[model samples]
Target: MIKALFKKEFIDTIRDKRSVVAALFGALFTPLLFAVMMTFNIEKARSVDDVYIEINNADMAPQIVELLDRESIFHAELPSTGKKFELNGETHTHSKISLTFSDDFESQLSSGLPANILINADYSDQERSSQIRRVKRVLENYEGAVLNMRLVARGISPLVIDVVDLEEQDTSTPGSKSAIILGMLGVFILFSVFVSSTNVAIDCSAGERERNSLELLLMQPVSTFDVVASKTINTGLFGLFAGTLSIALTAVVIPFIPLHKIGMAFNFDLEVAVKMWFIILPLAFFAAAFQLVTTFHAKSFKEAQTYIQYSIMLPLIVPMALEFSKYKHAALDYLPIVAQQQAISKLIRGELTDFTPVIGGMIVTMLFSYGLVLFTSKSLKSEKVVLGL
Candidate 1:
């Protein structure tokens, strides 16, 4: 009986072309956008192009000028008018940054006094801060070279200046190294559940009520529990379909992401996909039950939409909040959104030891979902609720 009702609801949901398209689009949303943005940023960071800065008293600091040139920074005449220009297919703009060597630059260096190199840029203007930083780096490099030379000339070891040496040794395995970058994928997977089920949940609950078919369906021999179960199951299937496609699309899209350039790698494979599926399986039901419960309380189809849109944001918001916070607990890993994120991230890094956490999370999420289904089923038996009052 539940299968008959589920098949009926599922067929009705499939007929909504706009809703299916939206679900498909939502599946591709994060991977496509984040990939493009990250690729552009990585290419920009790695490619070295000439940065032009105005130089004053160039003759007084020939060594500094040469050092700057070697670093691909050079002096160039600025156009009097334009603020931006295209160079080698990349857009660049004059930052109006200037380097001014003091009048007594050579004298100060020879006398072992501090040499002043004034870097002039609008400090408050955030847009040109990168130019300002690049200029400062060159000056600091020159200063370090002079300091080493002075120490060696005085029969002192150049190493004497260092009280301690600090070196970094990265212990991150290739799989674990990209956890931060790939954590976003875990988040998108969970959010896709709500995106896929919104239309179906609203249609099965609020849409039927608005069309005056909800009352007629209740007049049948079927119990309200069977009706609730059928709707929740159908809605969850949509979420599952969207989630599966999201994983498949992400798997295809991840190869193109240049995580290697940033010393990160997405260890996506069949095993990880299988683990992620286990994590999202219960999330599908959770999202469906959550959506249906909220939509069932609405007075009309439009109100259901308003409620579902706001209610669905819980998936996006909870992970963002807990992930950013410094406080973390073992209990949180057993919760819904946070659990899926943690589980998927561990699975990506190949660090998942056992199915304990993910399976526990599945149980907790399903319990909440089951509770919502029962509550909604009980409400449906009421005359006020079935009539949209």
Candidate 2:
């Protein structure tokens, strides 16, 4: 009897041209978008050339120019000959630089007077900041080396000028390397969940209602619970398939990424990939169950679809809001998507696999799925939800 019900639901879904097309397009569209975005980001970062700086100084300017050249931080270009500076040009004023020396630069230094150098840069260009900082550091080095030479000439030990030196150590894990990508992964999961499950859920509930076929199925020998359960299983199966495809496509594409060039990159683990498959299966079940409950009470396929679309968006909005609000994930060892994301992130970076979260997420997902199915079955007994009220 259960097999018959499953077969009927599958056949109904297949016959619905709209549902089939939605799933196919959603599945193909998502991977292509991910690939294109990743490729563009990698190439853009890898291709930026070193910046160029122009200096106009009389005294000690040669020393500063030598400092800039030694670091290879920026190339020194001659003054522009054109009447006007064109920042829009592909090569020339793409950026502007100015370095000026004091009128009494060498005299001030000889008399123990404070000396100053002026640096002007196009602050509007965001990429120019790092090069600016690098140039500033080289200038500081030149100052320090000169100070040491002066002190030694006066028979003074340079040790008196130094007190404490500090160093910084970055302890962030490689998994946590790209907070943005993890955030992106969270978004991608939410997208796949909604796109994969929306059509199936709407078709099973509202679609059935619209066709007048739901009434005939209800009149049969099967219990209402069985009917609801069968539909939930069918929708979930499709979601699980879509989820698996998304993950598989991610794995295939990640290795091709230029990890070293970009500051952040995704590393794949076979074990994590396997674990994601397991984690997503239960998540798919819960997603389908949740969608069925939201859609079951609607009058027409279109009405049910509208309600389910909102339901699907909840997963996307909530996780993202949590991430943006900087809400540290609770002990996700017992949470669903939180745990799966946490564990998968760790696994990707070749860290210790916390099975506790994986098992906990699975159990929570399944329990919720069962509860949703029960609610859906009970709602079927109400004439309002079943009879188009």
Candidate 3:
């Protein structure tokens, strides 16, 4: 009897056009969006290898110009023009690095006196900052040579000018860089599972109730538990399949994305994939169970759909917020989508899995699924839900 009900539920779900389209697009769209966006960003980063700089201080500093040329930093002579930045139709000029030399520049250096030169550029432009750093390094080297030449001319030691040397220590690991994206990808994957399961679960539970079919099925010799179990199992199965396909697409596209530019590496291990899928499995049941509970109370198929659609927003927004804020969400081990988000994100970052959370989440999800099944089954025995009252 249970077998017959399960088979029937599976068939009916597969035949629904709306469910099929929703599942198909739900599985396919995320990968397409992520792939295209990453590709565009990568191409844009690769486009501007050669940058243009206009220099105004040609007469004041032969050493500065010579230093810039020797380093292959190309610049064109613009009209004693100060550096102007135009972004979004707004222009700002910084003449800080723009050299306007004093008339007795050579005399000052010869007399061991400091000569002023102008420097100008926006410190805010990141790409321009990189260029400025290179230019600054060259200027520092030129200053060192001039300082040494002056010291020798004065019969003083150049070593007296030496001071402190700065050193940087970078302690960040590969995992930290991958952590942000790991969370985002996990959210996408878990949301895929939730979305793919929603249609089938809602249609099977609420659509059947609205069509007056659930009452007939309940009146039959089969136990209400079997009816509920079959619904949960079938929806979970379909959701798993759709989710697996979407995950596979992500796995394929990650390696192709140039995440390195943003300091992320898209490396996936088979062991990690298996663990992530395991973590995802219970969420599938949770989604199906939640959908069933919501749908059983909905008065119509459209009403059930509206509820399910809104339900999807919770998974989308919360996990994304956590990712952006870099909040460590350990307490979510028992929360449905939150649990899945945390676990799968850890898996992506190659973190050690705590069986406690994974098992605890599975137990919480299963209990919730079974409790929902019990409620729905009891509700199916009522005229209220079955008759859409």
User: Each model's C-alpha lDDT?
Assistant: 0.83, 0.73, 0.75
* Model 3: colliding residue pairs: 96-119, 96-120, 97-119, 97-120, 98-119, 98-120
Cα lDDT tens digits for candidate 2, 1-389: 77889998889887878777776665556666777776787687677455567665644657777777777644455445732343446444323566777777878877877788888887777877777787789889989988999899999999989887667898765456654555566456546755887898988898787778888888888898899888988888777777777777777776766555666656566766677678677888888898899888778887887787787676566566667888674564556566655555555555645677778778987888889899998988888887888
* Candidate 1 ranges with C-alpha deviation above 4 Å: 44-52, 76-96, 103-116, 121-131, 146-163, 172-174, 321-329
Q: Residue-wise lDDT of candidate 1 within 1-389, one digit each (tens)?
A: 99999989988889988668777877777567767876886788778767877798898899999999998888754647776655668666666777888999889988999888888778998867877778889888888998999999998998988989999998877667577666666777888877888888888899999988999999999999899999999989888888998888788888898878877777678878877887899989888888889888898999998898886788788877886886788888898877887888788767789778888988998998899999999999887788888
Separate clash counts for every candidate: 0, 0, 6
In the range 1-389, model 3's lDDT, one tens digit per residue, is 77888899889988898888888777777776777877786678655343335565456677677777777654543334556655458554432334455677767866778876655667886756777777778778988898898789889998887776668987766567756645667777777887887889888888887777878877778887788889999988877877888888888887887777666675676677778788888878777877887888888888988888876786787666776988675665677776777777777777755778877877887888788889888887778887788
State residue 13's C-alpha deviation in candidate 1, in Å: 1.7
Best by lDDT: 1
Pick by TM-score: 2 or 3, better one: 2
> What TM-score, to 2 decimals, does candidate 1 have?
0.86
Taking all chains together, the TM-score of candidate 2 against the true structure is 0.78
Question: How do the candidates rank by TM-score, highest first?
Answer: 1, 2, 3
